[model samples]
Target: MAFDATRAGADATELDVLIVGAGLSGVDAAYRLQTECPDKCYAIVEARDAIGGTWDLFRYPGIRSDSDMSTLGFPFEPWDSDVSIADGDTIRQYIQNTAAKYGIDEQIRFGHRVTDANWNSEQACWFVTCQTAAGEQLFRCRFLHVCSGYYNYEAGYTPAFANRDAFGGEIIHPQHWPENLDVAGKRVVVIGSGATAITLIPSLVKDGAQVTMLQRSPTYVVNLPRRDAIAGKLRQVLPKRVAGSVTRWKNILLSMYFYQYARRKPDSTREKILHFARQQLGDAVDADVHFSPSYKPWDQRMCIAPNGDLFRALRKGRASIVTDHIEGFEAEGVRTRSGELLEADIIVTATGLNLQLFGGAELRLDGQPVDTGKRLIYKGMMLDGVPNMAFAFGYTNASWTLKCDLTAQYVCRLLQRMDKRGEAVCIPERHEGVEADDMVDLDSGYIQRAKGFLPQQGTKAPWRVHQNYVMDLAVTRFTKLDDGTMRFQAAPSRSASPTQTATQAA
Candidate 1:
């Protein structure tokens, strides 16, 4: 049976759990809470006035899933679409439909941008403050689950060009693409060599625009088919549920094998990746010049070109790539440092995102501001010394939802354990013999820009944040909950642990 908080005349001000953000992670958190922890009351508070988080926010042309939909889609409700590399609209609709079908949408409070959350240790609850259109509003909950992704929503990172104002035509960032802007019959110069630039080149060409991607350096690129052949075959014979499970696992294993292979033997993996790019490009473009990367494979994410669409656009002379630093923007276009002038009618800055944690909401423990970066993440969900709080962050190598789903399920287990123990407060405490490291190993631009703002992961198990799904599955599902790290206190005895006040962070 579906849990409807609104229909039961429950107090919206109080809840068993409070989830922030309505994106992929938020929706997953809500569904898991409803089914697994049916007795617990919860509601979703979305910063935006919509359901889809990333898919709803990003409206750039040719925006699609970087990974296959089979692995990216929620496991319980599998993606049935034939197109494995789905477009943004399809994903947005899928999320919306899921929320409506499960009555999760009815539990949402739209336009509620969470600002601050202060723990009330006496009550073993969190008073979460939100900024809304009407003004500020506060809600209290036993557990605070933040599903907001780690990127800043209000602004994207854009380096200051020497003469940005001098550009005569329209200059745009893919983050806030203007709906009325037309790209057809225009010479568009896109800056950056990341995933956004790769996806945009092909789409811009299809809209009758000649695009040239300008980058300071090259990035590794791979092509995958637009549709899944195995998915087609499986669905033809098997039931929908069985087919989805098989296909999801198949894709997951293949991706895991490739990622591990890249990590172990980078030289072999790099050459193999180049071979595919060379075959796709032929003599149309110099693979060594445009596709070669400076860093090792998997050091940063490899850009995916669906169906070799970006390559096709380059091979047919519909688009091009320039590997050079920019002197600055000119009236006509961007000028390269090499004395080459590339003119364009429009400019698209596909630079990257600015990483933000908890949707820029400040967290506090007993009225003292908690420095999130100073704390080590326990099991990649809860932070050290943060009681009854969990966050959803996804994988860097594979599809995001795979890790997010596991995180939500683990959170549910923690809630159940608290109930079983008759405890009102539960927190993970950092112990000795554990060293801290960067939250993620990747050196991507977004990750690099957020050195001090991001949290750290431990070097040992229980505290270590591994990217492998199989290992995560073993730990989150099979491991015992009372592993000696998570501390639970009955309501009468609940107080900020004495150890928490002394050494609570990294």
Candidate 2:
């Protein structure tokens, strides 16, 4: 895994499908394509030394999934673990196991950081440039699938504060959490109110740090336990598949009901959830100040785990919540707008990640550039007018794996449809009269942050992200495979002349 970054610079390699990441999405895509089209020449080029994607990168204390493992884990693989919520190490192990099970590890090229990719319209191929431990290398491929994920590979956003340079204490970003960095007994101030901040506060407090969660605004925080004992016990006694099915259904129904309630009865539902947080924390804390949010639930992201360890941590007095506007940074602490300075020996910016459009990688079709910002999403898989390329994006409301599973299945269907019709390429184009607003997804910072740079989907079927597995399965999995949205044309043979060739050489 030791990459010299100098050796790989020698030459460019040609591949039928050049995958730019080895993360869950990338690995999943490779798994699907390899199984479906075993003859296709493909390689997964990863920037890191090992696989596991996000699981490998995030190794902070108490790193675990926010959602239940049943839904979070891949569909083909059942997470047969008794525990409903899994920790970071377990998740990492699961990923490794899954990769090995599917023989995906061997195909992943570690330490392969993609620097640039330019699509050649005339050749119908992509010239990809990357840097590895060995050196820089170019890869030519007929198709490119960027599973780099939405988060910028670098650190998440950290606002410039006055006198930050003068501060001598340790500063860390969650994305770049060091293995040897110690927080034990240090006065730790975790800045941000998203899932990372919530997860880290309780974790660091257990490590003997006086943790304080600093937030600009309140987020909907629900307290749940780390394990669902009843569910675990049932799973232990009943068959794993049956138990998994039951648990999955329960979680899905509950999630759907909550989402429906939030959308239909926003005020009452918000009060109900806020009450739950207050009950968990008790009267010692200011519920109105720390838990109140201006927006409805799910309008922003909701943080949850099996049992609310964060609430327990707060109630135990190991951690405290500070909802205020940060003025700036002092030498040894954070200065608030109220003129109070909260001293911290270490500051962890657990701020949210910056969502990149198409994993921040550029896209082009033919000679003309295809700006994702200006495009529309076709069935949330392919972009309108982009030929022979498809993206894997999951559900925003439910577990990511479910939507991704559907996407993979749908891609297979699309490919099969093309093959049956003897089409060389299939492109889905949006109708002329479609309005812009219908395509816009005005939700959390994760989606809205790159609204323009992302492909737009309408509120109706195919475009709408229902998050309901049954609804999606009906549409994406079992719907008529041959849809009229896709245009088909015959593929010219390899010996075809320049004017007649349908595909460019990789």
Candidate 2 per-residue lDDT, tens place, 1-506, comes to 33222332224566767776776677778788788866567788888788777788888888888787878876566677767778988988887888889988888888788876665544445667777777777776656677776667666777676788766698888888888777788999999898889888877887889998899898888766667666687687888777777777777777778777888898998899888878888976787888898888888778873477888888878899899998889897999899888899898988677776555555655435678776677776677777666666666667777767677667766656655675556667676656544343336655666666766665454455555666877888777654666675555443222222224543
Per-model TM-score on C-alpha atoms: 0.95, 0.89
User: What TM value does model 2 have?
Assistant: 0.89
Candidate maximizing lDDT: 1
Error of 2 at 244 (Å): 3.0
For all candidates in order, the CA lDDT equals: 0.89, 0.73
lDDT (tens digit, per residue) of candidate 1 on 115-211 = 9888876667787889999998777788999999989999999998999999899889999999967889999999999999998989899999989
Give the Å error, residue 310, model 1: 0.6
C-alpha lDDT of candidate 1 relative to the true structure: 0.89
